[model samples]
Target: MRIAQVCAVVSTLLFTVVAFADVKPNQLFSDHAVLQGGMSVPVWGTADPGEKVVVSFAKQRKVTTADADGKWRVKLGKLTVGGPFVMTITGKNTVTINDVLVGEDWIGSGQSNMAFTVSAKVAAFAGMQDEDKEIAAANYPQLRIFMATTKKTYEPQSEISGEWKIATPENAPAFSAVAYLFGRDLNQALREPVGMVVVAFGASTAESWVSRPVAAGDPQIKTMLDHFDDLYSFYKTHPNATTDQAPSAPQTINARPGKPGPLRDPVQDQHQPTVLYNGMVHPIIPFAMRGVIWYQGESIVGGKAGVAIYPHVMEALVKDWRQEWGEGNFPFYCVQLPPLKNSSNNPMVREGQAHLLSLPDTGMAVTLDVGDPTNVHPKNKEPVGDRLSRIALANVYGKKIEFSGPVLAGMQIEGANIVLHFSHAAGLIGKGGPLQWFQVAGADGRYVSAMAIIRGEAVVVHSDEVVSPVSVRYAWDNYPDGANLINGAGLPAAPFRTDSQDALSAIAKDFTGK
Candidate 1:
């Protein structure tokens, strides 16, 4: 009996060693966990070819075999999102992931400004004293945050590492301030446990988020492809690159003398393609998201250059994301670029941003009235997040409240004056305070300050100096600090340019076909 027991122990030890050596947990529960409501959930894993694998989640079992190249996956059927669950994936060995929750998942993306941190924007927090009380008293044990750890690779990454963290004062502040603020409001407003997957890099153009094959295929996007090649190549070469060594956070473009070189080396900026998408976004495409909130475009805006191609880029990104996730036309909301400091009265970037609204079921949250003239990183994120919530409430969740400020619809030429019609003017009043940042230009194409009066559903604009007004503009400064033209609901109208004497168009035509 003693000899038999010793032989059995030796056999067990050998089996354990062989299993450990042969098994690898190369994939993860994707960054964005799909919410399962009354349906079978698909939980997947990857391993060596022909390797038998088992996934256990929520009292269900799924079995699959790895392909010839050592890859495997499985789907568990019909599980709900009410979980403090653990998923154990076993093949030759066993790997267990704990504290997994099923809930609504969202994608927070865009440029550097979107990637801005809460601690970096100190003032944005000061206004949220009431929110602070709520954050301090937070007890939602089910809420989880999956930060898409930043990476750059030429090929899609098989795995990424980040764990679920409960929202505490210590952990919550480091979260994307915009994403967290938005998530907090949604979690409270909807009363459903929310999970956010932040997959943004600062200073990234819309093109960076798009796949190379998709961008290269579009005629309008080909120009941008040439520009992003080098940036992409750099990302592919340096997968673990970061901006912490620079003066700012993940997204700031630091071209200062002391700054590390561009995210990619300067010499390769035009040589490589799909670097950022491969390294940063490719690995994220498989994760499912309910919707996306984007905050970018500050990096890619050159007035004329922005206008001709930005809309196409927006379309490409939307289409690409939908294709990757296999979800059709999910809600996509974005923050319009705020006011800035240029003497010109015809701002094209804002127009480019507004143009994205032409796409179906998309919303733009304007910040014309909320930005500082010199500070590009605006401190007021609460209103930005709140405005976004209104969209989710109205368009996504189907609530009917006044969610927008005034939006420019069109204008009519009435003799010497231009009558501007606006949407979202249901409860507009202009008597108590000043209505500012209106400009009118004549046939000579020179814009001068004009007196604007809130005339019923339209703003009638005219300048005495220019009798035959060919063009009119509102809140058109690069950074219109005093852009006070907001509705009673406090949402700002995005900056705009009419077809009337568009200077930037002429400039773009000059550069096109060159």
Candidate 2:
């Protein structure tokens, strides 16, 4: 009996070791997950060398063999918009994922506002407006969230640390406020399940999201890279220097249990070069998402080059993400930088965001009026979410609703007055008071405040100081407080300028040479 007991203990130890070394699926493929519907779902993992793997989900099954490196994948056929399905993956051992739903999936990526949770309290941060109320009322099961854990790496990471959770009053407080509101509105409008994977970092730069190879290859982006390299060299040795902090502290993005340390080389942190995309964005690729919504650029905005290079960075990101996902022309939307009391050229960034509409299948959510001049992270998040949902509803879902504000279409000098033509100009009028923030400039190019009133479908402006109105600017400053031009749909018109030789635009040209 003693000899038999010893043999049994040895056998149990060996079995446990083999079990731990067998095939494993990503945590994202686990229970309570939402897969993107209407697309080929990719199931992947690793196993023993040359192991035959089979993945079965819904009514479809696929088989593939693990490579020499133990990596394997199988692509399930396109699925419809409905599921409470179970997925089974079998190799030497079997792994089963349960209670998975199939529906719309989107990625929300950007800076602090994108990272701003309905409830976050820590350094370099503040909580969302009415945080407690928003958290207590949350009870949506279909609006699932998969928040990618923060990990800044110099090289691309294959796996991230996080799990999907159903939105509840308990868990919703930690979810991204904009993402939650957007997903809530989306689910309500589509009447289907919606999931958002937020991979945002506070105080991150645009260059950080673009890969080094891509940035090095592009002339315009390379300029920004060179400047960052020079600045980081100074910041690393001079620890107390006034440089932007790393992309984020691990605890800031998620309320992790233990305190985390800063990067070994602060210069190569997530805020620098391609650190963000390498660490945060890469681990999440090929997840099969519907589209993306972005809200960032505050850290990258500058006087001239910052604005000019912004459009290029936007183009790089759009191209890079689409290339990574292998999805064709997915909808990309972003929120414009709202008004702020800080003395910076935020309008330049806003204009660059507006210019992104020139890209195929891209949209912008104007929030000029929705901003709090005193606060960067505005408390009014519902409107921002609703506006984003409006764009998706009208453009992607085929809903017949006015999704955009009055877009500047053309400018005409109608003898001593500048007449502005607009798209979606129906019911164009100032709200709360008379029209404000309109300025007209003459040949000498000096702008004086002007009187603007709606004339039929256009806004006509005139000023006593200018004889010939060559250019017109509306709400064209860091904080245009009373700029309240909205369309009939009540969406505010984006801040704009009608001059080709404007100082900001000219400075941008000097840097970008475009």
Candidate 3:
């Protein structure tokens, strides 16, 4: 009997050794994957420690050895704009990935809107406009999409769950609507394959997607970490506390009796700083991609403090992502929050989003004219995706096109009037009616409704109430009802304010229903 037991133990040990010896690529390298074109592509995976792994793809072969941790990576030379190639990774065991494509690759991330799918089959996602028609026509074999499962964790993880899928009528319905449209547009315009990896969670904050080390270093964001720490401490001391008794406690308590550490409620508490990054984003670090598109900021918590620090949060996220990816200022485009009724702080949030334009290679897609006042998740995502693609087409792909609407470039104060100069202001006009939603203020800082006119690529504003206007604002309410300003390109102008004053109180009465 003892000899039989010893033999069984030996068999188990051998099986474990053999299992660990097999070379495995990251989930991202599976069949039907799309590699970013025009850049050195990175292919990575794991094997037995010290094992040499050779990767061959698209007429290029690269070799590397797994370190003490059994992790290895190889970078292929810059690829051209076409592929239906195959990749082979050889170590102790050879793995072949077929039907691979090389082309433009982008990462789409943010909160619910970015996660919104092309169809409303899922309970969580609100379907886009003409969902059935769009789904039926979504047959592009050149477009691939990968959606990372939503998750949160206190510590960074090394693996995640997802796979690349070729866009088709069957699969495209589940794809992110904005991302799908963006990829589809690129595939037709650039006439090449396109891939989009979407990683997003509903109601997630920007700070939640930031790395722990990055958030810890920021003074404003560190407070959020501190708050989580306190919540953890409370839960640790009250092991027997019920959910009702401890209202803020994590839903599940997976604590061991004698091993004490920070208790994580990843399921219930997604807003915790760095949680989303640790679980969903960290595992995919350094994945080769052309750029990122983001849509968030509807659920900013912390009241005034949260609203004030949003621009800084976005700055940190953009810089950290670029630094981690080792990609120098790759285009980071974002969607500005659209008009919503009764959302008092939306203008402030939109202002904060615009501040991201100060960073290099960054752009904002204005949605001022494409919002649903009743529904935060508007179904008119075609314009949103088209606008984002316009930015990329113009800025990244060298397409000569008008990618944006009028932006406040300069403001000059003349007696009894404030003249606002704008860039991208060719053929500026108000659709369907006269100019509206323009407001002006005198030295007293009291804003009142003003009349505005388009005058040679500039909007001139004057109010009988303010003879000498000191400030001018356009479409500055939560929902500016008649703000019809647009450029000749038919793109709506982004909301703007010339002064940095707290105008919430001054304009509160004007937007009472909004």
- Winning model by lDDT: 3
Across 118-196, the per-residue lDDT of candidate 1 in tens digits comes to 5543435223335465456555555556666666555555666565556676666566767777777777776666777
Output the better candidate (2/3) by lDDT: 3
Q: In angstroms, give how far residue 379 of model 1 lies from its true place.
A: 1.7
Q: After superposition, how far is residue 375 of candidate 3 from its true place, in Å?
A: 1.3
lDDT by residue (1-514, candidate 3, tens digit) is 6999999999999999998899999888999999998889888988999999999998999999999999999999999878799999999999999999999999999998999999899635479899899989999999999988888887888777898988898998889999999999988899999999999988888888899788889877777776666666667777655444433522221111222344445334766778889888888888889999999988776566677777888899999889889989899999988888956337888888887876778888989988888888888999999999999998889999888887776778889999888878888999878999999998898999999999999899999999888998888888887689998998888787877743322221111011
lDDT of 2 by residue, 215-284 (tens): 7888766765565555555556665644244332222111112224432454445556677888888877
Stretches of candidate 2 above 4 Å error? 1-20, 121-124, 223-264, 301-303, 501-514
The candidate that achieves the highest TM-score relative to the unseen native structure? 3
- Which residue pairs clash within candidate 2? none
| lDDT (Cα, 0-100) at 412 in candidate 3 | 86
**Model 1 stretches astray by more than 4 angstroms:** 1-42, 75-81, 121-139, 223-273, 301-303, 342-346, 500-514
**lDDT by candidate, in order shown:** 0.64, 0.78, 0.83
Q: How much RMSD separates candidate 1 from the native structure? A: 7.9
